[model samples]
Target chain A: MSERILSVLVEDKPGVLARVALTISRRGFNINSLSVGPTNIEGRSKMTIVTELESVEQVKKQLNKLVNVIKIVELDPDNTIESEVLLMKVSINKETQTSVIEKANLSGAKSVDVGQDYAVFELTGTSKELIKFEKLLKPYGIIEMIRGGRIAIQTKL
Target chain B: MTKEKLSGAELIVRTLEHLNVSTVFGVPGGAILPAYDPLYDSPIRHILARHEQGAGHMAEGYAQATGDVGVVIATSGPGATNLITSLNNALMDSTPLLAITGQVASDFIGNDAFQEAYTVGLTISATKHNYLITNAEEIPQVLLEAKHIATTGRPGPVLVDIPKDILNEKANWTEPKLEDLPGYKPTLEANPKMIQQAVELIKNAKKPILYVGGGIIHSKANKELFELSTKYNIPVVTTLMGRGAFPDGNELCIGMPGMHGNYTATTSIQKSDLLIALGVRFDDRVTANPKFFAQKAKVIHADIDPAEIGKVREPEVPIVGDAKSVINGLIEKLGDSEIDTNSWLNEIKDMKENYPLNYNQEEKGPLKVPYVLEELQKMSEEDSIVVSGVGQHQMWISLHWKFKSPNTWLNSGGLGTMGYALPAAIGAKAAFPDKQILALDGDGCFQMTCQELITASTENIPLKIVVFNNGNHGMVRQWQKIFYNHRFSASELTHHTPDYVALAEAMGATGLRMVEKSDVKRVFEEMFKTNDRPVLVDCVVDPDDMVFPMVKAGGSNDEVILNEDDLKNI
Candidate 1:
C-alpha cells in the first residue's frame, strides 16, 4: 500500500535490467513503473522505479545486496521533485471541441497532434495535476490514454 | 607475459591452475566436453563423481574440510541443475565453492538445443554471484574474479556458466589481474566506536553466553573466540554449523542450542541475559520463533556479512567485520580480565547437572542411535572427521559426538540435504588423507547418495560409514507420529529399500549389521580399529525412538519438549 520511489545505479550489461526486475519479482513485488537510462558515468545506468513496498527498508536492504546494483537511493518526498507526462486522445467533435480545448488549456494541456476526428493532447506536470487533468478529460470520452510514469529528482539544497 | 594462442576451455583450466586449485570434482557431459579435453593435461586432480549432484557436495566437503575454496565442474541442463542443492547448501553454510558449468552454443542457448538450459538464471539466487560469459577473452578475469569473490568476505558459492562454442573460440592467455574491485568491497575492520560500545555491553552483562558459529572456523577466529570466552568466564554454546568451531569437550562447552540440541544449551540461551553471537545467522532452527527467542537477552552479532546482521534477530550491538578482526579488536579493547559472575556460572552448572542428555541405556529394545553414536564417538580417533547426512541419525551424531578441534565435525546444516555425507566424506577424506573419517547417515539419507561408495572404494578413501537403520525416515516418521496423529505417509522406507549392508558390500566395502545394543561397543571398537578400506556399519536402531529437547515448529525455544510426558500435555 506504500508506494516508494527508488533510484538504482547498476553496471550496464545485457540482462542487467532483467536481473533487477527478477530480484524484485522473486521477492513477490511488482514494479509499478520503471525507467532505465544512461547515467552520467560511462558503462553505468540509472534505474528509476516505483513499487508498492510492505517494508521499504527491507526491500532496500535486499536491493543493496544485489551484485549488479551499484547503489540505491530512496527519494525523500520533502527534497524530491516528482512529475509525469501523459498523452490522451479524447473522442472530440465539432459540438464539444471548443469547451474541450478551453478545459485542456486551463488544465495546462497542449495540442500535440490532431487527426480528422481525434486530437492528441500532451500534458506534463506533477502526477497529481496530470491525474486531475486526465479525470477532467474523461467526461469528454477519452479514446486512449498513455502515461509516462513518475520520474523524480532529489534536490541538494 | 606474452599471449599464448589457446581456446577458452584451455584458458579456463590454466586460470584455475594459476589460482592454485588442487582438485576439481565433477561428472562429464557433452557441453562441458571441450573443457574436459584440456583438463587431463592440467595438474589439478579430477574426482570423477558418479553423479553431478555428488560432485557438487564433494566440492563443498573439500572446501569445508580444508579452508581452501573447492571447485566443481558440470555440463549444462541436468548437470547444472544437479548442483543447485549443493550450491544452496554452500551458500547457507557460507562455504567457499566455485562451480563452472557448460552451456550450449550461443545460438542454441535459448533454443534448448542438446542439453541447453538457463544455467546462470537457475543458480543466481543460490550463489553469492554468478557469471554467464558473453566474451571468450574475459573468461580468465571472470574466473579470477569468481575465485576472489568465492574465497573472500563471508565465503559462499559462485558459479560461472560458459557456452560450449565459446570454449572452442581462440583466446589469448594472459596473467590474471589482481586488484581491488570498484564497488564490491567488504568491511573488514570493526568500527572503533562500535567495538567500544560492544566492550561496554560485555562488561555489563552478568549472564553471558558465547553463541559461536561456522564463521569462526572460516575466519580462523577460534583462538580469539576462545580467548574472549575464557577471559570473560562466559559459557559457549555452538549452533549446528558452529558445533566444531568450539572444542566440544571443554567444560565451558554447553553444547548445541536449537532443534534437537541438548537440554542445557537450549535452556541456557533462554535464561541468559546476553548472547554474544559470533558469525551465527540466527537460523530458524536456533530461534524456532524469533518473537519468543532469547526474549530477555541482548544479542551482540559480529560477522563479515552485513546482510546477515539483523536479517534474523536484530543484535543490540552489530559489528561488521571479519570475525577474526572483530574478535581481535574486542580482545584488544577488553583486555585480559575475567568478570566475577560466580552466581551466574553456578546457576548454569546447576542447569547442566539437572537436565542431562539422557536415553535409556538399559532399555530392552533394538539398538538405540544415541548409544551407538556415543559408542562411536568414544571409539573413534581423537582427531577424526565426522560427516553426516540429514535425518534423525544426523541429530543423534551431532548430539553425541565430541569434537576436540575445529573442522572435525561436518553436516548439512542449512540446506539439510539428504544423501550429502557419502560424497562429502569421500571429498573430506581426500582433503585429509591421513586422518580418520566417518560418515554417520540414516537409512533413508544413506540411500540417497550411497552410490558414491564406488568413488570411495576406487579412490582408496578409507571412510568408515555408519548407518543408523531405523527402517524409515526417522525424522519424518517422528514428525508424523507426534504432530499428525501418527498418519503414516511416504516416510516409511520399508518398501523398495535395499539391504544397506548388501548394498555397501556390492560396492566393494566391508559391511556389517548389528541388531542388539549389547553389540554396539564391540562392533564399533572392532570395526574402527582399521579403516584400510571403506566399511559400512548398519546399526539397526529402535524405530520408535525420537530426538529429545526438540523445539516444535514455530514454538518457543524455551518450551522444548524433553520427553513423551512433556509432549502429551502439548
Candidate 2:
C-alpha cells in the first residue's frame, strides 16, 4: 500500500470530524496525519488527510457516504506544495553549541526555545528537509520532537 | 414570522405532520410519556406494539410494503436497546427507517436514573445517522434533517434521542425550515463512459447472468430490469432479499443464488464469464468467502451506494446510480441487441432438471415445510404480502413462493431476526388494508414476538399467520446434526413449548391447529372466511425435515447438498 493524500471538503457541523474519524477507524484504515481548516466558502471546511490505502477508490466511496462529507479529491504528490513545522528540544554543551547554531543557520531553521541544558529548534520545510534537520540534531541529543503534519493545496498552473 | 411557542413533543408531532408521515409503530413508556400526550392530539396514527422489537420490525415491514420512510419510537434503557437488532437489520438491507427514543432528563443522564441510558452514544455505530437533542428548539430541525438523511441516498435507519425534560420544555416555533445541508448531495446519474464500458463487456461475453437483489425493489426498477434481461437474453438470479424482484415463473429466471440457493443459479455464477450484478450489495452470504466469489467473472456492478460497489469484490465497471436509472441507461445504449446465450441457457436448464429442489411429503411423514409453502402460495392472492421469520421456514418461502410483484416479499435477510414475520405482517396489513398479508413463520420464530397478535386483533388487521411446528429450532438443529456431531443441546424446544392454540386464543386471535395433512385446505378456507379477526394456523411438520440444497457455512457454493441421498453421496 502507498500513502495517498486525500483532500476532503466537509460541512461545518458539530461532531462532523468525529464522524469522519469514526468512519476511517472503524473501516480499519490508519490515518498517518491530518490537518483541518475552514475554507474560503462559508459553513464548510477543508481537511487534508494522509493515509496509506490499498485502494483509493474504495476509501473515496466510503468517505463519500458520510452525511457531512461534501467531496474527496486525491491530490497528486508531485503537483502539490506541502510542508510541516518541526519543534525539537536538544541537549547541548559548549562544544556542541557552536556546531548546533551553525547547523541551524545553514538549514534556515531558528531557535525557538532555550533552557540551561536544552534548546528547541523550529524548522519549516518539506518532509525531506526535516528528515535531514533531524539527523543533524540527533548528535546533540534530542529530548523532544513534534511535527505538525502536512497541510496543502494544489499550486496554480 | 410567528413566534408561537410549543413544547418539544408538540413540535415533533407538528414536524411529522408537516412531513406527511401518516403512521408510526411504537410502544409508550414512562420516559416517552410526554411525547405520547402530544401524539394523542396529532393526525398521525401511532400503533402500540407489544414490544420495542415488534415496533422496529413493524417499521421495517411498513417501509418495505409502502416504499416510504417508516418510523418507530421507544423509551429509554431497555426500550432503546431493544431497537438495535432491527436497526442493524435495516442498515444491512438498506430500509428507510427512523427510530425516535426517549433519554433520561438532562440532569439524570449520567447518574443512571430509572430507565436511563446513553441512547445516542450506544447507538452511534448502529445507525446511518443519529441525533441527541437536549434543547426543545432543536426538535424541528433535527426531525426534518433526520428524515432527509433517512430517506435520501442509500436509505437506512437513523435515530433521534431526546431527553424527557426537553419534551416538557417550551420552545418558540417559526415555520419549519431546513438549514442547507452542504455536504450530503448524492450523484443521481451515471457517467456515460462507464455505461458504455459495461455495454461492451456484456456484448462480448459468451456466458452472462444478471445477479439481481432487493435494491431492485427499493428503486422500483423491476420493469426496467425485466426489459434489460429480456432484451439481452440473460438469465437472472436473485438473493434472498431479492426474492420478489423478478418474476419467479419466467423462463429467464434462474431462482436465488447463495447459501441455500438453487443449484442452477449458484453454479451459473461460478462458471459464467460475465456477471451483470444489479442493485446487489454482494453480501457475504451471496458471495460465499468473498475472496473467491465468482473468481473468473468480469463483474459489472450497478448500484446506488458507491460504498457497496467495491466494498466486497471490485467490479470491472462500477456504475454508481439508482437501479432504474442505470438500467434505463443500459437499455438506451444497447437497444434490441440480441446475444447468443442459447448454449448457456441450455446448460442452466440441464442443471435445473438434474438437481431440482424436491422433497416428498409422504416420505417425510406428517407434513413438509415446502408443501406448506406451496399450498400457501397457491391459496394466497398473487399480490399478497408474504413476510417470513428467520430460519428454515424463511428459506422455504424464499425458495418456493412465486412473487410476481415488487415489495410482495418481506423478510430480514441480513440480521436474520426471528419474530419479524408477525409484526412485519401487521405493518404490511396496516399499509395495504385492501391487499392480503400473510406471515410464513416457524414454531421457534412465532414464539419470539407472538405477543403482537394482540395488537393485530385489537387493531382489526386480519393477517393470516401460518406457523410450521417442527418441534425444534430446525436450522440450528440441522447445523448441529451436520457440523456439531448430533449434539442436540438446547436446540429442541419440545419439552417446554407452549400450546400455540391456547396462546392465540388468549390474545383474541383465531387459533387453528392442524396435525393431519388432509385438513390443510379446509382449515385454510375456514381461516380465510373469518374476515373480522386474525387467524393463526399451527401445522404439525416433521421434526426431522431439513432444508436441502444447502451450502454449509464458510463452504463454497459448488459444494452444495442437493438432497437427503445426496448428503450421503457427499
Candidate 3:
C-alpha cells in the first residue's frame, strides 16, 4: 500500500482532533504525517493527514464516517505541485564552503548565519528536491537536519 | 423579589440549581465556608460525608448510576488532595465525575500559598480535563466545559479549581455556550474495511472466542456484543473489568480470563482459533503470557481508544472505533455465516463441571461469603447494579456472582481501590434510584466510608450494603498467609468495630447483623423486605477464607489454584 495524503477541514474545537485522530487510528490506518493548523476561514482548521491506505475507496468510506468533517480532499502528487519546508544547519568552514554554498543556491535555499561555527539554511520545495539537496550538502559536513514533515497544497486551479 | 448582591456562596448555590444538580456530597472546611453559606438556602441538597474521599466516591456512584456527570465539591488544599484517590478511581473506571474544589485565593497562588496548589497541573493526567478559574466571568463556561468533557468520550473525571477570590467576586454571567474544544475529539465509527476483515475472520474461524472488556459497558455496547455473540455462536470470555457484560449463566460464557481467571476460560482462550477481543485492553493481568495466550488464533482487537490497540499484543485485524458502532457494523457484515463451536463449547462445559468456583465449608462456618453473594444474586433482578470494594470480597463476588447485564457490576477494576464500595454504591444508587443497588464491601473497606450511610439516608436513596465482615483486608491477609509465612504484619485489623446495626440506626438507616450462620438467609430476606431506607448487612465471616482459584500475581493464567488440594498439589 503506497502512502496517500488526506486533507480534511473540520470545526476547530476541543475534542475535535481527538475524535478525528481516534477515528482514523481506530480504523487501523497507520498515519505517516499529520499537520493541523487553523484555516483561512475563522473557527475552522485544516488537518493534512498522510497515511498509507490499502485502497482509495476504503479511505473515502472511512473519512465519510467521521462527524464534524466539513470536507476531505485526496491529493495526487503526480499532477499537483507539492512542497515541504526543510530547515538544516550545515557546518561551513574554509574546507567545504564552496560545495555547501553551491548546493544551497542550487536548491533555491537562503543561508542565515548566527555565529562563526555554522550557517542555517531554509529550503522550501518538493520532498524530492529536499532529499537531493541534503545529499549534495552531506560532503560539506552537515551538523543537523530538521525536515518539517510534508505539508502539501495544489498549484493549479 | 428583591435581587440582593450575592456572595460567592450564593452564586454557587444558584449555579448548581441552574445546572439541575439536585445533590452535592462534600465535607465543609474553612476555605469553602463562603460557598457553604449559600448551599444552605439552595434547592440542591447537600450530603455531608465522613471524609472528603467518601464525598468524591458518592459523586462517582451518582454519575455511574445516572449516566450523568456526578458532582463533588471540596475545600482547599487537603480537601482537594483527598479527592485524588477518587479522581483516580473515576479515571480508571471511566466514570463521568465532576469534582469542584475551592482554592486558597488568586493573590495567594504560587506564593507557597497555605491551601493552594496548582490543582489544574496536579490533576492534568488524572482528569480528562481540568481548569483553574481565576476570573468569575469564566465560571459558567468552565462549569459547562467541565461537564461536557466529563461525560463525553470514554467518560472520566474533570476538575474545576475555583479560586476563593473568584468565588467571592460578583459577576453577572449568563450561561455560556459550550465552545468547541480544539484538541479533544472522540471517534464513534469503525473503518468499514477493518470491520469487513474482522467479520471475514470471524465467519471463517471454527473455534472463535469473544473476549469483551469494560469498554463495552463504557460505550453502552452490551446489547450489540450480546447480539453478535449470539448470532455467531461464539463463546465469550470476559476480563475482570468486563464482568456483567454478558449473562454469566449463558452457555456460551467461558468465564473471566486473566491473571486470576478460571482454568477453563484461560484454556479456551489458549486453544481458540480466532480471538475476537472487543472493548478490552488485554492488560498484563488478563494476558499474563501473551505469547502463549490466543497463540492458536488470529487476534482481532476492537476498542474505542486508539492507543490501546497493539499496546499489549498485536491484532491481525485491529478495529478502532466506538464498540457499539463497530459491533453493529460487524453484525451487518456477518451474512449467513453459521459458525458453530459445539465441540469447543462441550469442552468448556466439561472443564466448568469438573472445576467450578466452589469453597468447601459444607459443615457451615461462622460466615459464608459465597453463600451471601449467591443469595444477593438470587434476590436481585438481572439489571440490579452491584459495586464492590477491593479485596478478597471483590474477587469472590466476581467468581461466584452471576451478572446478567452490563454496567451492573461497578468496581475499581484497574485501580483496585479498597474504600470504593460504599461511595460507589452511593453514586450508583443516586444514578438509578429505581434499580436495586448493592455494595459487596469488606469490613476493612466498609469502615473506610461506612459513614456514607448518613448520606444514603438523607438523600433517601435505598442502597443495600453487604459487609463481608472478615475482620481484615481478606485479600492482603490471604497473601500474607500463602506467601509471607503467615507473619501477619499489619494485615490483622483487630481494631474495635462499631456496633454496625446501632451505627445504621444512628444514621437513620436500617441495619441487620447476622451472628449465627443459620440466620444469614433470614437476615438477607428481612433486609430486602424494607424499601423505605438503605440497609447494611453485617455478616461476620472467617478471616482465613481466601478467594481460591487464585493465580499468583504476575503468574500465567493457566497456573491457577482451584482448591486447597490444588494449592497443596502445587
After the best TM-score superposition of candidate 3, give how far the Cα of residue B19 lies from its true spot, in angstroms.
4.4
Q: Which has the greatest TM-score?
A: 1
Q: Which scores better on TM-score, 1 or 2?
A: 1
Q: Specify the CAPRI tier of model 2.
A: medium
Q: Which stretches of candidate 2 lie over 4 Å from their true place?
A: A37-41, A85-113, A116-149, B1-3, B106-114, B172-180, B568-570
Q: Is candidate 1 or candidate 3 better by lDDT?
A: 1
Where model 3 places Cα greater than 4 Å from the true spot, the runs are: A1-157, B1-19, B381-383, B495-499, B502-511, B531-533
Better candidate by TM-score, 2 or 3 = 2
Against the true two-chain complex, what DockQ does each candidate achieve?
Answer: 0.46, 0.56, 0.06
lDDT of 3 by residue, B1-570 (tens): 534455555666766787788978888886677888888877787777778899998888777666677889998888988998999888887888888899888888889778776676566556766777767766777787778778776788988888888778887656557786654567779999999999889878888899998888778888888898888788899888889788888888877877667778877887789988888888777787666567788999888766577767778998878889988999898877788777877887898888777765455666668877786678776788889998788888888888787777888887788888888888777667788888889888888777778878887888788888877877788888878878788877652367777788899888888865678778888888988999988787877887777766666665777766677655
Candidate 1 chain B — worst ten consecutive residues by lDDT sum?
B493-502
Model 2 chain A — which ten-residue stretch has the worst lDDT?
A53-62
Candidate number of the best lDDT = 2
**Models ranked on TM-score:** 1, 2, 3
The residue pairs that clash in candidate 2, if any, are none
DockQ of 1: 0.46
TM-score of each: 0.95, 0.92, 0.78
lDDT score, candidate 2, position A157: 50
* Among all candidates shown, the one with the greatest DockQ: 2
Error of 1 at A156 (Å): 0.5
Ranking of all candidate structures by their lDDT, best first: 2, 1, 3
